[model samples]
Target: MRVAILGVGLIGGSVGLAARQRLGAFVTGHDPDPEAMRVGLDVGALDAAGTLAEAVADADVAVVGAPVGRIPEVVEAVLRHAGPDTIVTDVGSAKGAIVAAVDDRRFVGGHPLAGAETAGVRHAREDLFAGAPWYLTPRSGSSGVVFERLTRFLAGLGARPQAIEAATHDRLMASISHVPHVIANVLVAQAAVVLADDGTLPATGPSFRDATRVAGANTTMWTDIYLANRDALVDRLDDVVHRLQTVRADLVAGDAAAIAGWNDAARADREALLAVGLAGGTAPSCELRVAVPNRPGVVADVALALGHAGINIHDMTLSPSDDERTGEVALWVDADGASRAAELVAGLGLRVEGAP
Candidate 1:
């Protein structure tokens, strides 16, 4: 497979490196900054660097890694120059706007939940996305062939690919990721104001340090992200403010029981949320074989169904019949969910059975 990375920044460079080193793909890159392109090539993240059109001319997949603000325009250019069969995706955190902007069936909105505190092409690593959740936002009308190809490629790169609606992805990110960043920034600003009068800041404990870790990260990139998902972010922010007001009321009333309950509730909520990722960790792993007919959107429909039902696919492989009229998809999932996964696949009018 040939992959083209449209921006050779940290995420784009990592994607290139993973594609080349892991999948042995011919990875070409194009960056608005020539220095990023040069460094990307020097770091072995790319086989070559050139103009956007040249890079994507023959690519099987083209990933737009530009900043969130520029993704729409870059994706438009990528689609215009890429081959008709080339699948186009992006690593932008916000997917709703980008997906709506691109009306083509070949385009799939994606955001990998992987990154490093350090930035730039030089810091890119092939294993950055290993064991990470890579969300793919594909509409119902999106091409199943493109979605399947992208899913297989991402899996090869050691990333877990899951299908979700663009709007749902945006809302989840707004609540979990964006709102935390905002809180971090606000905490730092408030601390600065409180310390200004003393003319010297006191040492902070881990609580303060950890809470403000993402405080002022990549201002330019984050500005675009905040604005891109403004509506969702605003709604979440309002919820945060209302919750804070309740806390303030409890403190003002000196309600120790309410305070304890609030603190314990936070701990419980955190554990519950984290458990979602660790659900099948202790369970034995198994595979389910699904017999499906060769058709457009069939793979995507089944994949999305299982994903929406909260079944995690650890690995997958597709085997087509000699006549290409039928195929079987082998899905590796935790033993605890294998039976349910088979049930879901079977409900889709496909033949599904567990691998004994």
Candidate 2:
């Protein structure tokens, strides 16, 4: 099936790469930036870059990986052009606005929790989505075929499929991804003022570097996440403010126990979540695992192999590695049905490994 990706930036370029590896799906992208298009074509991230209509025409999936702000318009345009059975998706950070703009039953609001500090197609890499969670928010009365295809599509890309309602997705993102992006920007602004006060600023260590690394992402991109999820962001922002005030008050009081308590609680909560996340079996669908052949199509090969096995995959994630030949595929399937799936996959002559 052909897949069209509009925007052709990092996200759109990534969708192309994933389609290649997961489904061997024909991949095309659209972007006004000729240089970005050139980069995608040069790097082989896209089969071709063309006008929006051409990109989506007869495509099985039309994905809009544009900026959060531009997503609504881009998605609506794709909705108008999509084939009758085309599954349309957008990788916008904020959901409320875009979902409302394009409420067609064929549409699914997707936000893959993955990205690097870089922007543009030149930075596009097939490894970007390894082990990431690709969320899907289906509109009511939507065609299940599109959702099923997307689930497999995301699985083929080595990402876990997380189904969420649009409203819930927006609220969750405000607390996790969107709000953090805004806070990163605000913190960077604060750091700038502090740096200006001194001739030399202290080198930000790993913690600060990690915290603010995303702050350097395109401001125009972030502005959209903040605005589209404004209501939820505001709620999350208030909670953040309260926590900040409490921390400040504790510091002012010189209460070591209070500070320690805050740190201890945070560590406990985070560690607990990590423990569960670690067990997601490295793939979105637990039923199938894709063995990526270090160089490319690692994801697609795995998905197709599993599909051929007729295994009902729940979620999947692939292990990250620098060696293109040593990719690890993790499949999530029932313990009772796992051996058959594993044996069939191992027959492919790929080193098939699983959590069970």
Candidate 3:
């Protein structure tokens, strides 16, 4: 299989890495930035491609990993160069516009619910989408064969592919992803107003830090996302405002019972939603821990090695010692593949700490 990745940044590079290292696909990358293209090659994510046309000329699949604002244009260009049977998809966060713009049978709108706070190719990891939800938004005219093929390919990359409509997907993302980002920025802005003069921001607790972590995100990328999905975001923001106003009224009236009830209901609802999301389409997995030196790219190396061996890691957590010289990585894999995964890690000169 041949895969062409456009805009070889974090998501694009990760797709290339996974396609090559896991699926044994011939990956080619096209990026406007030369440095990003170089990083993709250095990380074994993709081979060299002189231009976008060259990258997708004979490709079986072309993944448009450009930012939300540029996705429509890039997808159009990809469709122009892609083979008639080639499946074209995008990893843009906002999907409605892209889906509307591309009226091709082989085009499938997709958004991988996996990323890091950091951007750029330097931070790309092949395991970024492992056990993550990769949403597919196929229109009525979309080819069923293309959808099935893409789903199977995503599953091979360890991603859980879920089918959803474009409008519903946009609204859900607005509520879950975009609104939280806006709230984070607002919370941090309010905090700055209070702390600017006193310089006592250092006293903020972990709760505050965690809540505001997404504030001041990649400005260029987020600006594009906000504008593209402005309508849905505004609707969700209004709902949040209404809820806040209701809470304020309760507080002003000293209605303690109402406030308590609201909090309890919210907690219950959140727990239920989490349970449902976790339980759906979940497979049994075995957890294995491996002790290794605490160093850069150790996790990436372990993940790539496992991918090369066709062992998909469902999830992973790294626990570093206080001295930072050693750490243990707890990796979860399919129950059937656990034994082989252990052997693969052990072969890497890392100690397998416990039974799988």
Candidate with maximal TM-score: 1
Q: Candidate 1, 252: how far from true, in Å?
A: 1.7
lDDT scores in order? 0.89, 0.74, 0.83
After best superposition, candidate 3 residue 124: deviation in angstroms? 1.2
Clashing pairs in 3: none
For candidate 3, what is the TM-score?
0.79
Worst 10 residues of 1 by lDDT: 276-285
Top of the candidates by lDDT: 1
Instruction: Please identify model 3 stretches exceeding 4 Å from their true place.
Output: 197-202, 283-356
Native-to-model Cα distance after best TM-score fit, residue 173 in candidate 2, in Å: 1.8
Better of 1 and 2 by lDDT: 1
- lDDT tens per residue, model 3, 258-322: 99999999999999989756764455788899887865445545654554444555556667789
lDDT of 1: 0.89
Which portions of model 1 miss their true places by more than 4 Å? Answer: 279-284, 292-296, 318-328, 347-350
Candidate 1 lDDT at 273 equals 89
